[model samples]
Target: MITSAVRQALRTRGDEPAVLCLIGDLGPDRAELAALRLRGNDRRVDLDAHGMGRPVTVEGIGGEGEPSSVGLVVIAADGLTDLRRAVTVTTQLPPTAHLLVVVRHVPAHLGPLVPAPPTIDEWNDLHELRVRRFGNRGWACELCFPGGMSVAEALAAVVHGPRGRRRGPGVGVLGGLSGTQAALWRPGDVAARGVTATGPVEIDRVTPVSDLVLRLDDGGGLPFWEDVEVPAVDRLATDATVAPEVRSPEARLRVYGTDPVSRVAPVDERFVNPIGFTKKTKGPLGELVEVEGRVVVRDETCVRIRPTPDGTVTENDLERVRHLRGVRVGWPEHGDTATVRIVAALAAGGVPLIGDPAPMWAAGLGAPLAELIAGGAEDVLLDPLRREEHSIRLRRAALRTHGVRTRWRSLAAEAGLPVPPETRVSVVLCTRRPELVGFALAQIARQRHVRFEAVLALHGFSADLPEVDAAVAEFRATGIPLVVHEAEGEKVFGAVMNDAVDRASGTVIAKWDDDDWYGPEHLADLMLARAYSGADVVGISQNFTYLEELDLTVWRGYRSEVPSPAIVGSTILADRVVIEDVGGFRPRPRAIDSQFLLAVTRAGCRVYRTHGFGYLLRRAGGGHTWNVDLGYFLRNHTEQWIGWRPSVLLEGVPAPFGAQADRHIDHPGEHVERL
Candidate 1:
């Protein structure tokens, strides 16, 4: 396969640096033909053939520690006999290799002794099988069949004596049919896959320039019509009507007579296939033995007939049988030609099939194959651990099967831990644009059902601006007790959050952004979820037309069907103790918030999601964390914090004092000293 692909690729890349390898016994004719095909196509197809000229045997494939170096492998069905060897070759191929396989359907064996529409007694013994060879190969196989000659010739139209000197058209029935009358179109007309004149009354054949065509209605109770192409003739059987009804069980049939045809009678609905074969018993051999069997052919439509004294298996007592179950038995079209050819070439070294064939087989083949494959196995081997999918699914299952159970609030309540009824809720916000501070404070003041203290952390600037001071003064005048914390140090988001948590005297702290507009019922939802989970942290996911349009602080609670926490970021944590215990977040710019959530979650805290619009994240151009590649940072950060790796923390964001931020990686001694 690799050799064929390489040869083909070389031919297509004319004059390019190309190489080819042949393993095992190389057929003289095949090799010569391939060489000729490649050479004639272009100079790039230059055969720089390599590998042991002596046939590379199947055993040599993926030999010991050896790996075949090939860009792409094409396994044509012509050379293969042993499908297992082909699968093995593909399975062992390197990660970068590409593979292609071609498939061809073979005819099933129904013994010559028991002809095709087998006798009731022979139906069970003579099985008509459709072998889906390589039934388990995961490789995509393209099935191709040869198209017939020209359209008219393929349809098999009758021709008259001569074009110029035509014999009188054979007299035949001219039957017409039409669909139900409607404003425009109706599907009342019948079409057929293939049709034949049923009861023939000879008609004169006239040679026309092309195939004759007709569109007419054969008057019947139901409005019906047909578009037909049939050889015209005289002396047609006009006594028979044109049957314009074609069902899978019966074909649209027409009879020709000496006069214009009368209405055509419908064929029995039980008769499948326009063309059929049936034989009636002639001797007492048919009466003594009851013929009771079902024809089981793959691909073709078949009928099952059950036999009884009254319901002796007859042509009329059968129904279409779709799928059949049996061990397929047959050889390729050109026996051992393509199969032997494909197998011989691929056996030398076939591509290692990607993904497990068992599950894929079960999926494609359904219950029968799935049960067969898993008859005696521990479990199906899914995507290997090398794939992110395997690990992700496992993690998700773990979280769902045994979810986080926190002891903080429960233990506190059980141990009669003191409850501060007057506990305040602290709100924190950060913004580069100070002008938006007023709106943020107004929303905070509007929380009628909640009591909370708000803090605005403005970005540190070398020189104080009048606008900043005015925005601070404006927010303070809203009658909402506000603290304008001077963010003078280097901008580290985690550090800023820690500062707000430390300064506020609140039992629960909620995080927020400055520029985001809040939903009126946002605070109420958080309190409700926190009360329900009885946990320190609450989480939720945001629903928005665009991610940037979402309020980062609030989110509609997670859907019940989610089975897991949705938004890990927009969660509320009780007090500063858990936050302080979690080491107060790494001061690095990227993934600080996500990293904090991971720590809280790992610490056995319950996170609940609220439904509806939570909070929106106001996107802006520059921030120490946002300036660099945020996606790259978050992906690594998640892998490190969530997947566990401290070294990931050391790979700090490219920011001022990014190195110095490590000093704050560990919690303040004073905070931990009390814990």
Candidate 2:
């Protein structure tokens, strides 16, 4: 990948120059390899692998003291901090040099540093690799390497082979389906089934000419098949209204879900419009207004309702409404397809508020949907304080229950087709602080909606201690699997983590810190983000922190719900396969998390950062591996409270031991000396 990227950069420059300045941290071996490749092409390469803020100068090609202008510059950043330093190098480069910045992992939030958008070549959790270029015209796809194909073979094919379309099975649709609805069907499955027509297709008539015939229904009554005395069609119904003759165990209704694109799109924090209603507007009781000849409505909060036309909500439509805090949706009445689609679109897009979900009980989504409904749009939806809180909850629920793949998998199972097994996670907790063992185990025990086992690795301590033994017994009583590994003399944090990972038998592995607090749905939310984003690793930002010394809580303004190069080390969750692919964590004493992320990104795997409302990082005096001081967090915090005030997602979670007493500190200034 690096060789190809360098070749492309050189080709784009149009001409060779005196010197090619190589900067940033690409490790010594990679730097040498890159230099060797360039030398074979007869290019003069100058390496600066440590990112020492060196000036790019043509030393060998120019006069002894005269500063020579550079021709091509390539920066290789290892992590987010290194990426920022690499961006600064562009300012120091001469006007003649054409700069190309290459990072092993590209973070979602690049900030306002880059002059233009950088092109990205990403490999998803599936083996497929896609190259995307961003310019004034937005993102354009260059190429896609299919799954199970080696990268070298794909590159060679792109260079020499003819670009011919591969043929597959044919599918014929009898009725019109919205783009959102059409996206639910996998391309391969649709091609395999010769006819995927809407309900009422005669089975005997179509099955003779086609390999497979699938009849799709929109939850409406099967009026077309009402006259047929013995309907022998293989059906796919969205609701519980199939014909009695065909109501076998394999013919049950499977509730379909929202489009996948909406779930992966970045959430826009700046809310220009407060309330939005798209495609359907039957039950949103509000004052009507006309703006630019378009229908608009204003509720009691004076928040205007931006309504889209009564049609299918496209991908572009979902992207546009990403900034809206609340989306007003009508009840999914029986057989009301428009309302159903609207609800799903809003839910998957992470819209904070949705409404009138009383009628969704018949649609197989009663409890989760009811939790997100707005009782009164003006009262509940307009509350600014709870909007972000609601968004976290709604998006988490959508990932666990309403993903398109999950819906399709359910349908495939009911039809007696093959389906993938459910995902199981292994939570790895490594700690030297034996005092915090019970606190950590309690948090792990509260997690829900995921099949997970906890692997506790005690560094420089024994699990036989009274406090550790008692916590282990309490945690085991919850019926969850637990494995304890004692590293009595091991000092390296990274090696200890690797030992814990080796003991884990789960498909997915999550790292947990002993001193932090996590909500019940933390692991479930990470799984959901991974499913929709197709990212190899998924974790949360360190948005919330509790300063144990000063008895204060700080909330940082880090951007969540996007793809970032790095996340908080404690909240990291990744597939076990990717972990092994990257050769596990580096066997170092410090910066283990950052180094592991760099390795993953260098291997062309994506790292995604989801919402951090459920996690609370505790910063005690100074014994932690991450040795940043309390004052640093205080300086970067967007908001602060006197005591431990976590987000609403952590409301039911019990406070850490002795945290309840810190709530009585009245004023934080009294504990200023402790910092």
Candidate 3:
């Protein structure tokens, strides 16, 4: 029966699997049984019996050491007699190895052996009687789990107990083995249930759960799906601090007064009125920085006034005192009353007591002759406006100063089109200055290893510049392609640049000015920087310096060598397409680049900087530096501010200096929208 069972088990294990029949004998019969099992079945089965004596020894079980090649182990009733021997053998069976045992029909020993009594139907072989133990053994036997255990409780006990058979000492056995057969599964047949867990608990609309697989009628399964109520939080306030740092330490106090000589009250403790001036003040100097003050006490020849709480006064206050009526001349006119005492109490601050001399002070003073002034000064009164003109004349004589100059041509250049290409570019030259045209075009024609191109835009050209015309012809002779064009009339600078951009033909387009020059390797290094950064635009710094008066000589010496930051605005390297998509530059006549730059940044393009010589922007008579027309700039500023519109500036470039950038304007796209 043992031989039949071993053979049956070997046959069940289809392959040429090693079958270790760990019985108490290893004699020739055991070898023959192994060979017979091997021959009778399609699989090769080797029977390695543990002992050859009448009784199975504990030491015999030691041979079962992790059956590496063995598929199963057959433990006969005789071989399992020694508890220690059973353990040793079972322990040696590798985690994956299976065990099957058979026992004789010994009624007394079999009753307590198994948890269940085997029924007649449980035995497939009718010749072999079926037997089972009684009571719940706190674990389900193989027979109780024919369709697999519905719950983990019963199996847990058997897998956790001291011996493979004893689940709990006092637990009631669910079933028992009768006086004939033994239990079936091998040591390796038992599997461990995996414990799985989800990650951190997320308090959101959907929470995570594990092990629950929902099956649809179509045989598909949803491993995880969650539905839960989630309270909404304020998005703006979520990560924001309720109280931010106050940028201005003092409150701004606006005290309105129309009169030029109005006595303004002092400001509160934490604040100070730093200035006093007319609302619609004219003239550049006063419109921005001019100030005025009032005098409350005046004597016949001087003025006595309370000093500011700070105990200090500025030159402007002294000038105000000097301009006051009935006030006599004092070395320092705004602070203290010592000068007033010298002029006496008869006159408030020191002047002729009879006449309102404020008007007289405004007129030419001292040794200058005014025919009517030969009589008593009080009798000769002048209108304030006329007095102001005279005061200006006197001040001019007293201070020995000249008036400010009005006309200025900060930056001037020729405007033209930009020729864009489709290949990796070695250089991009933008210019209008006739002097610089030669140097920039020559560099492009002479560049090696990388392809080169030029975009010469002539702005404000009255007549064709002879020098620039010659340079263009020279560049053409060298076989280097050049695109020369002029700016569209009646558009802002931003618009002018946008028009020039239509002609760029290179993948990596660089910026150039009519007065700017470049190093030989500038284009090569800029292209490399573009590749490494994976950016749409890269900027190089150009050193700024004042040039000579001549456009040509002035243009040649200016250099824009970038500083610490590699990225910048005015001078950038990028693809031409980026410029076209951003609607080009705005038509703002003043501060044209400023508006366009803002637009490019909003578009979401990467801006980087390259470490190399970029270009030289001449800081000479180049009228481009200062936006001479304020009205045009304000118009553009208002357009951007009100509509929140972006300027059609070049995109994909960084404006490193930001608000401080003067002549050039570019924008790095922040977010790009796919068309």
- For all predicted structures, in order, the TM-scores are 0.29, 0.59, 0.28
lDDT digits (tens) for residues 386-481 of candidate 3: 222233223222211110000000000001111222245524443444455555565455544357677666655521566666666667777777
Candidate 1: tens digits of C-alpha lDDT, residues 10-123: 454423222222221222423643554433212211111110011222222235764332323333322211121122222212221222333221112100111112124422
- Each prediction's Cα RMSD? 33.7, 18.2, 40.5
lDDT of 2 by residue, 501-545 (tens): 999999899999887878888998787766645467889878888
**lDDT of every model, 2 decimals:** 0.31, 0.51, 0.32
Candidate 2 stretches with Cα past 4 Å from truth are: 1-192, 196-214, 217-312, 330-335, 354-365, 375-385, 412-420, 654-675
Candidate 1: TM-score? 0.29
Going through the candidates in the order shown, the clash numbers are: 79, 2, 101
Given candidate 3, what's the lDDT at residue 144? 25
